[model samples]
Target: MKTTNLLMSMVIATTLFFVGCKPKDAAIQAAVQAKEATGITVAVTKGDVTLTGEVADEAAKAKAEEVAKAEKGVKTVINSLTVKPAPLPVVISEDPTLSKNVIDAVKDFPMVKATVKDGVVTLTGEIKKPALITLMQHLNALKPKKIENKLTVK
Candidate 1:
């Protein structure tokens, strides 16, 4: 009876020892998150860390992985972060240049009159429906800030 009791006690002691030695997932996640920048998400499961969310660039993504790996109790890091797409630059023509271009564009449509100010093109007068599309295409190619169509379409 004493031998059986001793064996049972040893098993219980071993289990507690192992459990106490392992770090909790929540604690590891908190440690990693504190060191990372904003916009990064940290998830921990059984000492494995997964990083997700959008970062500004590839360098930022790599840096986040390094941080997670460096944290204590993190067995491995899985980086699933995405890089943000760059925005397209807007092109706006200068007033003097846009004015000259607008005049040339509307010359073919005798019924259309165009005026440019502060990179904005204003169209007035009358135009046949068929020629309106062509006139607009020409003006848009010049990259004006805005186009105000006040033309009476026939």
Candidate 2:
């Protein structure tokens, strides 16, 4: 009976020791997350921290990792943050303004006829080889949605 009681006592003591030694993952995660910048997500499991989310730049990504590493009870830091892509510039000229500009651009090349619809300039007719380049450059400067060059170069 005494031997069985001692074995049970040992088992309970071992369990308590391990439980006390283990770090609180939730508390560590909350601490690290509070220190990090917006858009950063912090996850902690078994004292290992994983950072995930989109940051503005490389510096922000590094900063988030640093924050996680600085938190107590964090044994390892896994950085999985991604940098956000830059947005493309939008340039679309109004149809009326583009039409006026197209008319002026083709005026010097009388043989070339220009038509504008929905910010698209369509060129149909005949134009000198040398004048075609100049007319195209002028139309491109107006930032139309598209340009259809059907002019016959003579």
Candidate 3:
């Protein structure tokens, strides 16, 4: 009878230790799968999900939340995502002279395309002649905060 009692106690202790260790590994697996399936990388701690990485907009953010919540072991989801806005295309205004000047500037560069919207000029396309930082400096001189250059030239 004493031997049976000891075996039972040992089993109970082993079960408790295993139970304590299981959740951590389960949470890690859930986080990895959540990231792989949803494209939203997540970190799971004690079943709490932390959604991270850059997303396009709010919809992507909400979708990530839903994905993490769907995971069986997740207790709560904490969203922390950055939204990157799309660059606007270049469009000249009614004034011919000003539009022509802007066009001349782009033509001189041979790779940059500037798009003006609501007085917010977004320089898209590419630039090859000078370094990207130099081009940005010139554009910044033209307009302080209104310049959004989405050019990729190596």
Candidate number with greatest TM-score: 1
**After aligning candidate 3 to the native by TM-score, how far in Å is the CA of 84 from where it should be?**
2.0
RMSD of each: 4.2, 8.9, 9.6
**Top candidate when judged by lDDT against the true structure:** 1
Q: Is candidate 1 or candidate 2 better by lDDT?
A: 1
lDDT of 2 at 105: 88
TM-score of each: 0.65, 0.52, 0.48
Question: What is candidate 1's lDDT per residue for 1-154, written digit by digit as tens?
Answer: 9999999999999999999988899999999999999999999999999999999999999999999998879999999999999998998999988888888898888878888888889999999887899888889999999999999999
As a whole number from 0 to 100, the lDDT of residue 44 in candidate 3 is: 71
- Cα lDDT, model 3, residue 100: 50
Total clashing residue pairs per candidate?
A: 0, 0, 1
Error of 1 at 143 (Å): 3.1
For residues 1-154, write the lDDT of model 3, one tens digit per residue: 9999999999999999988766574556565564543456677777787777788878887877787777666788888877767878655344344345456556657677876555556777766645667666655545433667688776
Q: What's the C-alpha lDDT at position 139 in model 3? A: 55
